[model samples]
Target: MISGPLDHFRSGYVAIVGLPNVGKSTLLNRLLSTHLAAVAPRPQTTRHRILGILNGPGFQAVFLDTPGLLQPKYALQQQMKRQIDLALKDADLVMLVLDASRPDPDRGQVPPMLSGRKVLAVLNKVDLVRDKSSLLSEVDRLNKEGAAEVFMVSALRGGGVEQLKAGVAALLPEGQAFYPPDAVADRPEKFFAAEFVREAVFNLYGEEIPYSTAVVVDEFKERPGRKDYILVTIYIERESQKAILIGRGGMAMKRAGSMARRQIEAFLGRPVYLELRVKVAEAWRNDIRFIRENVYGSDRPSGTA
Candidate 1:
């Protein structure tokens, strides 16, 4: 998958699709060498299709980070699934990342989204698999099932990533760059601001709450040569859950805010003043109006992004 000498620019979208907890975000981050997508050790942490762009000499890989395909329980989950489908429809190439460390899928069974489109099966987290021979066999099995290629890589340990990158680049269609070479992502600062806070919530909170929660950046203002101030609201469904997020003496909320703010500052390349507040939305996941207001608004902000 090496580039040729009489080089031409290769730029196209590559969709990263997989089941839950398969390190799709981590893989995209490693590929781009940037924390453009939020990474957490929780299932379905990515709620929308996030784009992480990798621009190199003669190439720009716009890797789309899609939510894990799963059964929908609420309107929000349905939207997430729709995002995945849309990504598949638009991608020039598809990287189907599967957790090599996890329990094997039943023989002859396949992921539902394997229906149409050209895909490269990537066996991710290979470092976690103890039996190397078994892992190779699994990869070979996937290659037989319509994948144009199969790659084994550890997204965390940086194992076999170069090969994966080259494979992805080779699969992309020949075209002009969709975005500028310097652009790492298409998302605005506020989107990452909310996602960074959500990542902290996933890391700190227990089951159900993290999945139920969503963050909205209410206000973001910056003064030249001065610090930035950002106000964000953490949304949940129940009052008790809101109390849990706040914790005793606001300790939990403070910790989450502090951790997220540090990451935000690093991302912004300046000091940041972050303010977080929690509110109960009473089944926002099921409410289409609420989804239209907060989740949809935050995810698809107007203008170029």
Candidate 2:
């Protein structure tokens, strides 16, 4: 609880931008003190721009955890890049997260969109760094390159996160609060439900199964006095992939469903009856209509700038 005058109230969007596996989602979860975004080892795990709000006294920071920047190979990847573009357009400040353990520190280069914005270069995963001098050198190099400020922290271990939060709050411009203090995230429960299921698929499967798959919550019915019933359909590119997902005698599907159900239960704070089905959508990632409908959903209309 920070004490400040009404005139000093600050509220604005801070876009978290970075390359794949750079710990952007982990940093957001750490800042909000809740797991709003799904964390997995796989690249492009985050498909949408998730907004997490942090309110303290007179400040409210709307943090946008965006999809990792990468070269688009299909329509789905193009849409993912679009989401990042939108976040960049709406951001009041930008935080470029980088993997500090990498030998080449210059890889943390700022993107064209972030060129004139208030940028903070965050060197994440400092816990993995053994030499303190190398970390300082990396920070200094980033600072000299053009970042308004450079911060070193381990988002996974909660190290230097409090200081990062304080620094963000101080940099925000004075404005009205964008959301209620009690609100944690802007996305609905169903969006996270599908994400949890997709995460389970990524965790349970190997090879191309995770990348070639997408989870759609066909039905999410909540009963007042009973456990919630969620029906999800997993989309795959081929029948062979379907067999792999279902496994021998349906055991694989059962395991994945059980794991997803437990995750949903933990997230919703109630028991859930989850039903999963697999469907073949050949090269759906390259289909524009499917990408717009299933991936981005209706909230974000197609061709949005």
Candidate 3:
């Protein structure tokens, strides 16, 4: 159980896990009241664990937003899945976010993998449902899954968030504040830039294009007065993929850059001049070198930044 002053305590990590498109990113953003994580309408929009920090007078809670759970399609995917594994290793709490608007065949079932952890089943998107009784029944069903607690919340509307925050704070183990009271997140600036670019790609393109692509920020430099300058390369698996990203007279690229720049500016709270270049890495997702150099590079982006 949490150990610290009732109103002034510091804390540990909480892992938010769920299926793709279940509103994990939305929840994180609301909790932090900041755009620390990129939000896209696409499934698997989050490909890495982004940290969102909550600071109080005497407490701090660090939340880790993990990629959606799915079967690995390549080495990159397998690596992404590993982020969830790492989160489960020593988490102070695990939040299993399930969509209440949809039925889960495994709804009431708890995997043995979580047998020893403190688990909370969050029935998300409650506002989307028409009947509260049915939602309650679903909650009851999940209660049988070994979750220590249950919370029905609509991440989009900020419903029940205060209660959820209070509950989470109550569960924190006693310790010095893990981070400064004002720290909203732990990620480097470049990571957000990369994610912003990727989110743009996801929204601009349909189907395999979003999933098949990756973005790496090669340069992020401070400019005199115009704006913060960013240069990023969009990596794709094949040359044919390159054409799709570039488009005729670079219309597609222009759309992606423009869309992404707005979000980047919002996230950074400054004008951003985002420059994007498309390249073909020839199946980088499956190539070890590609994954090593890009996805899991030594300067790997982490919320713990």
Candidate 4:
């Protein structure tokens, strides 16, 4: 046991987990006060374990924003599950973020591999619940299920977020900081470039296009007096998909590249020359080896910044 008041500093990993489309990424972005994780209206938008380090006055809470836990349907999904498992194994505490707007989502059950760990139930999207009584009932239900604590907040609107942050700090074990104050994420800008491009793909197309796509930053070069050069490839499962992405005379690919470049500029606070290409990788989603080495290269694409 920690004995002295001087050892009051707290630092630990908090795994933020939930079912698909529960606003886990939104909550991560809200907590970090930055867009470190990718967010979209679609399920399974986050395919990696994105870290958000919140260095506060007395404590440092490293938040691991994981992909939604679900049954693995393909190699990509299986890898996503592996990422979640990694986070769960490393977590000092588990924040089970659930959507308050969803019907009967307050199960309050402990997630897999989280046995005997401190779990704080975050009933997010409270703003969507017009009936306050039902929300209270959800809280009461969680209490009955032996939750460590239940925090209500709207991650998108910033309601009740500060209180939740403080509550999280109090539960973390006392230790020194793991990361410096200036650092907000564990990933490089090129990693986010790939993610932002994928997000743009999600935003642009419908049906099976987004799911069949994987983005890789093939190259990133900084110029002393010119726009930074970024070369990216959008890997699709079929030639037909590539045709759709490229569109008439490459207009579609140009549009996605332009959209992603603007987002990357905003994120990096600098201009970039983005080069986008689409390639056909047949059944790559089912190829676990390719997914591991190429797409998720050390949590980023291979040979990239």
Model 1 clash number: 0
Candidate lDDT values, in order = 0.83, 0.85, 0.81, 0.85
lDDT of 2 by residue, 4-122 (tens): 34458889899999998889999999999887788888888888888889997668999999889999988889988988988888888898999888776356576676778899888
TM-score attained by model 3: 0.93
Better of 2 and 3 by lDDT: 2
Clashing pairs in 4: none
lDDT of 4 by residue, 164-236 (tens): 8888888899898988988888788889999999989988888899999989999999989999999998999
Give stretches of model 2 more than 4 Å off: 1-7, 302-305
lDDT of 3 by residue, 1-305 (tens): 33344755648788988888989999999888887787788898887777788985566788989888889988888887888887776479888888888887775555567777888778889999898688776677667767877888999999988778877877777788777777787677888889888988888898789988988999999988678889999998888888888999999999999988988888888998888998888877788788778866634444343
Clashing pairs in 1: none
Worst 10 residues of 2 by lDDT: 296-305
